[model samples]
Target: MKCPKCGKWSLMKFYICKNCGYKIDIKFEELVKRLTSENDDIFVSGMRDACSYTHSNKFYGVYAMEEAIKRKAKSENIDFYEPGFTYRSGIEYAEARSELLSLARKKGFLADVHLTQELISIWLAMYTHLDFNDLAEEIIEISKGLDEIHNFQLLYNQMHDTAVLNNNDVQRE
Candidate 1:
């Protein structure tokens, strides 16, 4: 079941959420697994949160992304019922997707994450503004592990593109 507190799916035996501790007396991890195995609304919720958080975090990229997504969706004649994706669009989704992943990234979620070419491209686009040195050690570790652990060769290759991932881009690490 969706944890009322953290909104994550939990194992039937798991009374506490790993992401955010929320205990429900109900034994329901199996149900959570079954539904989330296919899909879940939490992804959508996180998407919306990403948009709002990005807008609040300060910058216009998310806003611009929002417009771009809206235009693309419209051009493609893809109708969206959810406001989070359609209303917020690019900026918010990007921001939310990344931001929601911040903790996961820090905790090496990318290792467990199914890395794809699309994901690498998105990170490259979003983090092109980021410098290699500015990256957290954990982030660096994850980057390196992308190939070693996950065998994400596409991601590994793109990560070497100095134009986007570099040491001098942000003046931090």
Candidate 2:
């Protein structure tokens, strides 16, 4: 059997994963079933999608988390300004996140309990970053270098333009 927590396809001789030491239990599935406000089909579909996604990717990059977000959007029937724009755009991330959270809350998602419990199932059934904050910090650090690169490219273009202007001036003289 596959280990839900670590997404490892190992021989399930125990209730815990040998690869990452994650415990398997029925509580997580129960929590998911209880907390979801949508029809069972949607919830099941979302969970299935999440599991499939995790299984395919081997639990990389917010596995079931994306499914949770997608499930919410699907249930609400809300159209995003741009689908997945927040993830790629730093400027609108916070605002878009706030809106999503508000919608989630309205749709009976209790972050401290319901959502958290559901997430545990998702985590156990998939995987999430143990060092999420550190990863975010590293991405931010790398983005600073992107600004430097952008500035250097602009500077190089200016220099090239000036050289061309100087060459034209010599031709005119």
Among all windows of 10 consecutive residues in model 2, the one with the lowest summed lDDT is: 78-87
lDDT of each residue in 62-157, candidate 1, tens digit only: 222232233322332322111111233476536643542463345433332223323444444446435323443444465543222222221232
Cα lDDT for residue 80, model 2?
18
TM-score of 2: 0.23
How high is each candidate's TM-score?
0.23, 0.23
Q: What root-mean-square deviation over C-alphas does model 2 reach?
A: 21.9
Tens-place lDDT per residue, model 2, 86-167, is 2223434334333423423343222222333222222222223553334334433544333222222222222233334344
Q: List lDDT for all candidates, in order.
A: 0.35, 0.35
- Cα RMSD of all models vs. native, in order, equals 18.4, 21.9
